[model samples]
Target: MDKFTTLTGVAAPMPLVNIDTDMIIPKQFLKTIKRSGLGKNLFDELRYEADGTEKPEFVLNQPAYRNAEIIIAGDNFGCGSSREHAPWALLDFGVRCVISTSFADIFYNNCFKNGILPIALPQDVVDTLMEDAGRGSNARLTIDLEGMKVVTSDGTEFPFELDPFRRHCLLNGLDDIGLTMEKADSIRGFEEQMATARPWI
Candidate 1:
C-alpha cells in the first residue's frame, strides 16, 4: 500500500451506476492472488470488444483518460460481489481516488485497505464532479486527504467525510499488515516469552 496524502491528476468520468466487482476485473482474471497484473484488465468487458480490440467509446479507452488517476462515477458504484480485486484493479490502473454518489459497503472498505480512496458525496456534488471530469485530459482534480477536500480544475472545492482511522491509515500508508507490523516489538516479545516458558514445545 502507498501513502495517499494528496493527489492531482486526470479524472475520468464514468457515469454508469452499479459497476460491480466482476465488471471491474472480470472473474476470469481473478485466479491470481497478485494485484499487479489486473490493471490491464480493469473494466475488461467495457474496455475491450469481443475481438479484444480497445473500445473507443469507453471512457478509459479514450486517449485523454487512458492515464486517469481518479474516477468520477454515478451512484451505487462498486455494487456487487465483495471480491477485493475490484480495488486492486483500480489502484493498479493508477486510480488513486474515486468520487461517487454512493458505493457498496464491502467495496468501499476494500478501497481504503488497498490504498484507494473511495469518496461518497451527494448526488449533486457528484454530478458536478462528473461534468468537470468530462474535460478530457484537462480534467485534473486534486484530492487532499489531510484536508478532506476535492478541488476541481476550475477551483471549486467540495468537502467529504471519512472515518478518522481510515484517514490516518491512508496518510501513513498502513494496510492491515502494516498496522500489525506497527506492533512488531510487542509481537516479537510475546513470541520470545512463549518460547522460553515452553522449551519442550
Candidate 2:
C-alpha cells in the first residue's frame, strides 16, 4: 500500500453510470490472485476489441488520458459485484483517486483498502470536475487528502467528506495487513503467552 497524502495529475472523464466490477477488468481476467498484471487488461472489453485491437473511443485509450492518475466519473460508479480486482486494476493503471457523484458501498470500501481514494461529491461538483477532465491531459487536478479538497486546474476548490479513520489509514499506507503489522509486538506476545499456558497444545 502507498501513502496517499496528495496527488496532482491528469484526470480522465468517464461519465458512464453503473460501471460494474466486471466491466473494469472483465470476468476472464479474474483468474489470477496476483494484482500486478491486470493493468493491461483494465477495462478490457472497452479498451480492446474481440481480436485484441485497441478501441479508440474509450476514455482510457485516448492519447490524452492514457496516463491519467485521476478519474472523474458518473453516478453509481463501481456498481455490481464485490470483486477486489476492480480497484487493483484501477490502481495499476495509475488512477490514485476517483471522483464521482455516488459509488456502490462495497466498491467504495474496497478502494480505501487498496490505496485508491474514492471520493463521493455532489452531482454538480462532479460535473465540474468532469468538465475539467474533458480538457484532456494538460488540465491536471489536485487532490489533497489531508485537506479533504479537490481543486480544478482553474483554481476552483470543492470540499469532500471522509471518515477520519479511513483518512488515517490511507495517510499512513496501512491496509488490513499493514494495520495488523502495526500491532506485531502485541500479537507476538499473545502467541508466546498462549504457547506457555497451554503447553500440551
Provide the lDDT at 184 for model 2: 100
lDDT of each: 0.93, 0.93
Superposition error at 34 for model 1 (Å)? 1.0
Q: Model 1: how far is 86 from its true place, Å?
A: 1.0
Off by over 4 Å in 1: none
Clashes of 2: 0
In order of listing, the candidates' clash counts read 0, 0
lDDT of 2 by residue, 1-201 (tens): 999999999999999998889998888888999879899999899999999999999998899999999988888989999999999999999989999988999999999999999999999899889999999988999999999999999999999999999999999999999999999999999999999999888
TM match of model 1 to true structure: 0.96
